[model samples]
Target: MENRVEFYRMSKTSNPKILNRITEQILKAGFSGNIKVYDLGLDDEASMSLIVEGTYENEDCCVAVGYGMNRQNLAIRKKWFRHAP
Candidate 1:
């Protein structure tokens, strides 16, 4: 996920809420549309909603790092992902 790494290098925003250790702020938001996980690099093109400030965090405040596509769209690709960080 080279693009995901690049986002961390270039982003400047911050979150006030203490999120989980594993977190990913949206440099670009995603929406309900036909797309792929890698399309997250497209700041203005992805099908997700506009996120002024977003922190994708999990339970216990651990920041979740990953990509998201619409629920209905996942079946189109049937891709399985694993995260180890």
Candidate 2:
């Protein structure tokens, strides 16, 4: 098959909820690749932009997380990359 990339998100939900949702979707899609997670601040617009660029530029897909943020709570963003072996 021709090479392809995909993106996914399961935010605003509990860990279990997100895990279950993502797992089901990933399994159904039969995806195999590397998953990367990045933690961006709540209002860190500049960093967020850089993160997006870093994740998407020259890559197949990327995911950005933006929500509540603080020293204690941190939002998680993930990106999945698929390449030929």
Candidate 3:
């Protein structure tokens, strides 16, 4: 099996509604297993990332959800990749 990854970005990070909707969509798309949320600090600002690692279309997959400034998101992405299995 091949490893797969998907990325999503949000402009409004402070809204819980949007975050919930995104999470719903992700789950509906077929990623089901362990869901983990991380709070990260980057360059003096708070950032967040959600990771869903499971099976998508019957194949192993990972989906990363992030919000906030582009630079911050980039940093979060790098951090996730650096520590991800």
For TM-score, the strongest prediction is 3
Task: Judging by TM-score, tell me the better candidate of 1 and 2.
Answer: 2
State each model's C-alpha RMSD to the native.
13.0, 10.3, 8.6
Q: Write the per-residue lDDT of candidate 1 for residues 1-85, one digit (tens) a residue.
A: 1223212321222232311111233323222122122222333222222211222222111122232332212112222233445
Tens-place lDDT per residue, model 3, 1-85, is: 4333333343325467645654565566555555443333222244445555556556555445454433323221322222444
Q: How much is 80 displaced in model 1, in angstroms?
A: 10
User: Model 1 misses residue 72 by how many Å?
Assistant: 17
lDDT of 2 at 61: 59
Model 3: residue 58 alpha-carbon error in angstroms: 2.3
How accurate locally, in lDDT, is each candidate?
A: 0.24, 0.36, 0.45
Error at 44, model 3, angstroms: 22
Off by over 4 Å in 3: 1-12, 36-52, 63-85
What TM-score, over all chains together, does every model reach?
Answer: 0.16, 0.27, 0.38
Which 10-residue window in model 2 sums to the lowest lDDT? Answer: 45-54
